[model samples]
Target: MHIYSSHVLVCSGTSCTSKKSPELIKKLEEGIKRKKLDEKIQVITTSCFGLCAEGPIVVVYPEGAIYSNVTLNDIDEIINEHLVKGRIVKRLLSGNNEGNNSYESADFFKKQVRIALRNCGVINPEIIEEYIAYDGYQALGKVLTTMTPEQVIDKVLDSGLRGRGGAGFPTGRKWLFAANAKGDKKYVCCNADEGDPGAFMDRSILEGDPHSIIEAMAIAAYGIGSDQGYIYVRAEYPIAVKRLNIAIDQAKELGLLGDKIFGTDFSFNLELRLGAGAFVCGEETALMTSIEGKRGEPRPRPPFPANKGLFQKPTILNNVETLSNIPIIILKGADWFKTIGTKKSPGTKVFAIGGKINNTGLVEIPMGTTLREVIYDIGGGIPNGKKFKAAQTGGPSGGCIPTEHLDVPIEYDTLIELGSMMGSGGLIIMDEDNCMVDIAKFFLEFSVDESCGKCPPCRIGTKRMYGILKRITEGKGEEGDIETLEELAETIQAAALCGLGKTSPNPVLSTLRYFRHEYEEHIVNKKCSAGVCKELLDYIIIPNDCMGCTKCIKVCPTKAITGKIKEPHIIDQEECIKCGACLEACPFGAIIRK
Candidate 1:
């Protein structure tokens, strides 16, 4: 093992990499080499530190200094001043004040209890040695050498860990079924094909701690008596895929993944299968079908994956986050793991928070944390003092959480009771500027576009619902439009072919359930209270605020405003395009929308 005087960890996750963290890392490495301090100081390019809004993040150990928004220019200063002179770069440090500058003390990271994201920003993901140094494969080693197959399953079952991939099925029960099933071969499949928008929890884990997933999968294979496994990942996640392949190769070379792991008779082998970015494939059967070289579409249940899956073999499938927990549970015992979360739904959940939020990044908190805490304390609330209207969770398939339900605890059962499900943890915050009708339309359109078209309810029913939402948003809604949408949403939910279809109407249903007043306003009053439907709005010049500046008149696309140089302006409502250009260009604060 190599030790250094200082270890500078730079975030290299997708968010940070997109923001030129790579360049900063290269600069830091070159600077360290140039200064002849390679032996004393080491630079490690790791994964996301979770505070994406402040990326690219740099955390220097010894003092545990965290710096955000780092640049190549800042790298030289960091190396010279912080490394050589033993001085901290106060200017580049994160947090509102110097007291909470590091990630450990920062509010964003303090609220988070990272289990799946444990090694993300802490280790060099590209290197297997760093992962092993952190007790990475110890669980696998313990399971192979000490525990029996049924004992491993019993331990997992007692841990009370559930699937983190939307559905909260008991992990132990699923493993037991797969193990008990009579088949020549049983396979373990990892659902790394995370398709939800704003959801990158799995991707970050793969990029940062691929070894965790590998170790967990190996443990699962031992428990289920499966000698082969497959990880189904999306092609869009280039960083995750690259790191996973590296981890696999490294583990095989280290005699961890290949035949006779730890010199036992268990010869478990794992392979990678890339997905085509299909939203439907997030479902287990659909994912298995895609891995079998078929089009990704849902198959009817009852002969579930446990009985017949992936080339007609018995299979146990779990997502990246779910698998990541297995190693810890095995290492730390089920009682300790169960003590962290709720009685029914134990363990932590990782969410990818985005949309109108101050803290836009990945966060993993205990299962029972309320929405208020996650949105306000952890997310830093909405940006620019915007009023938070609602938050959309579970991607297009999940419902929106209104202000009335802010204190609701975020468990699978509670979320489902609130007309939402914890679907892969995509929590998108919406402010007052966002229209509920428009929000429904946006998600409905996404569902319509991404629909596999395997069934009529989701294929045509969702289209009809989207059409009604589109009409309402365009100010063409009729008296019966709301009733029609509600009816269609119910029908789709009850009659759709798969979970994707059944849940596709969630956005519309949830919006109507909570913000039906908005729908009524659009349908009856022929007005968009949020001023979102352009056709329903009319521009007017406020007589009191107008100063005859003629700014609105000059910039109006249709010349809607007319006035002399020193008098109040008059807007020609007939010619107004409702582009809000007059409102934007008015220096007198006169132009208003009615």
Candidate 2:
């Protein structure tokens, strides 16, 4: 292997790809070839660079010169100035205009501790050699050649790593249960079925470092004495699925995944299972059932997957984010891994921060990082000068953390204590414009639609809760509706069979816990404080502020606005529809929602 003079890493993550990073890559390659520098310059397509806001991003190493929002037209200048002449592109570089000079100076990358996402923007995911060059499969080699199955389990136990898949269960304990199960045939499963609304941590890891998950699965197979493994990924993630297939084929070709792996007696093989976009299938039992070619539905516990799973054999399932960290834990040693994070939660967590935030992208920080840091510092604070209202973490199954709990350390126990579980690490920030009652209703509606309906508590309880929330948002809520919603939430939580049904009430429960005042305003005052619930809001024209602009009339879909030039507008109350088009179109800010 020869070292190249320079490496140009272009982010091919979904966010950057949407911004035409692929075309930028092509232009870079063509320009390098046109300059007769292909031999010296290596252009690579890597995973997300974390700063998705500034993409299509290109980082040239080993100088670490960061270019934000690069285009195909800029490729020539970059090649002529930076790549060939070895000068930095000051205009394209990220960070403030004054102080900092390099990529590290950017506030986004400075605060982030990329553990699960370390290799995301650094290496070419499609190339197996690059993965190996970065100490990728070295953990599997170490585990296969030296460490016994018991030793592997003990190391994970000592590391204090819990599942990143939201349950926060000790990973080593789950592995031990499967290893101890009395069965002739056992299996290792990777749950890549990430269905959380705002979450892309799993998909990014899979797309950027599929080899990590593959290698981790192999090590898990060795630890649990399983000869077969399956990765149940959602079909929505076509790029991740495609790359995972490539990584698996490459692994098999290199004699890393087939019979007599690395000259050891252990034989492990992996297969792909595509999910039909069922959110309920994210649950372990439902995922196993889907893998077994059956309708995805959660079954009763006690006969957990460790005892009876996937063709009635003992099975261990870990999500993609959870598996991605396995290789590092093994290679770095348990004690070394344990020293980085909180005492109990010993690893980094990847969060998909979206909604009302300035910097919306995938962020991986240490486990004990505060919500304030994630929301204010890392997320660049809320957008549009809007006050921070609340943050919905952990997806539909997770709960909301209000502004009061912003100081909470984002650990598994701390979030759970505040009525939110770390479900796949999706932290959606809400601003003052967002209505808490409507937000809860929106998540409950999602839960109701995704429920498998196999269990009565989840099916009926979710429907009842959603109905109560709907009535509240639609201005039909009664005084006792809040009490009724709480009751239904409790029932669904206690009686539901699987994780999906049990945690379905999280959105409602958490909102009620923190933003009960919002619910009270909806039910008692018949008003939406955020002015989001259209049914409870009335659009009025302020004559003093109105410049008699007819712009609102032209844009109204319902033709509800009646006004002439140099005259105040009048909205037909019955035909208004509460669309707020007038409110948006008014130049003088005359239209107001009350």
Best by lDDT: 2
How far does residue 170 in candidate 1 sit from its true spot (Å)?
1.2
Each model's TM-score? 0.83, 0.83
Which residue pairs overlap in candidate 2's backbone? none
- Candidate 1 per-residue lDDT over residues 116-175, each given as its tens digit: 888999999989999999998999999999999999999999999999998899999999
**Candidate 2 lDDT, 271-319, residue by residue in tens:** 9999999998989999999999999988888799999998999999998
Clashing pairs in 1: none
TM-score of 1: 0.83
Model 2 lowest lDDT segment of ten: 97-106
lDDT, model 2: 0.91
Candidate 2 displacement at residue 277 in angstroms: 0.9
| Stretches > 4 Å off in candidate 2 | 1-104, 549-567
lDDT of 1: 0.90
